[model samples]
Target: MSIQLNHTIVAARDKETSAKFLSGVLGVPVGPRFGPFVPVEMSNGVTLDFIDTGGEPITAQHYAFLVSENEFDAIFGRIREAGMAYYADPHHAQPQQINHRDGGRGVYFDDPNGHNLEILTRPYGSGPP
Candidate 1:
């Protein structure tokens, strides 16, 4: 059996706001509801289940995405336009710059729920320049 990620639960103070924010940034629509989860499907067949926490403070979680260069540019533009800081590293030291890790470009930022969001063009520690 080949193992693949099915979905992940994203805790949000408000599912509607979080779903809308993610849908806007990712350029996708949040469609249909399933039980307590607001299912947001991606083009890649992955779903992010947004769970409402009713203003309860949530611990920050890290989520990384592998996107094309053009997608990176567009997402970066959206991040900057939203007035949020982007970093080359998870520590947010090199703000507004992409990192040259694994011989590919990578950037890091956070979502409204304080979830660390990362975009990279290559897999971690793999591939050539």
Candidate 2:
């Protein structure tokens, strides 16, 4: 069988909260708990499994999602509706804006657990410069 990513573990202070937060922002439903994970299946069939960190200091990680143009608009609307801070760049130097990278709209924001989250309409290097 071809190698594929089925799932990934995401550390969070509370798995349920993190999973719900992600699913809500992406406009997807949270899947049933499997073992210790609260799964959020992506459109690509890969799942982000959220697990609780038990209050330890959590190291943040960056997670990126490639979305359709319409999905980008809806997700961005939810982001702003929540009064969240977003940036055009991952480094966050450009705030309150989105980037036209790869000739498509993109933005960066942080989850409740401080993990860097990104949504882009085009894959890097997949479109005109």
Candidate 1 structure quality by residue, lDDT tens digits, 68-94? 878878877888899888899898888
Instruction: Give the distance in Å from residue 9's predicted Cα in candidate 1 to where it truly belongs.
Output: 0.6
Off by over 4 Å in 1: none
The C-alpha stretches of model 2 lying farther than 4 A from their native spots are none
lDDT of 2 by residue, 1-129 (tens): 999999999999999999999999999989999999999999889999999999898999999999999999999999999999999999999999999988999999999999999999999888775
Worst 10 residues of 1 by lDDT: 19-28
Best by lDDT: 2
Worst 10 residues of 2 by lDDT: 120-129
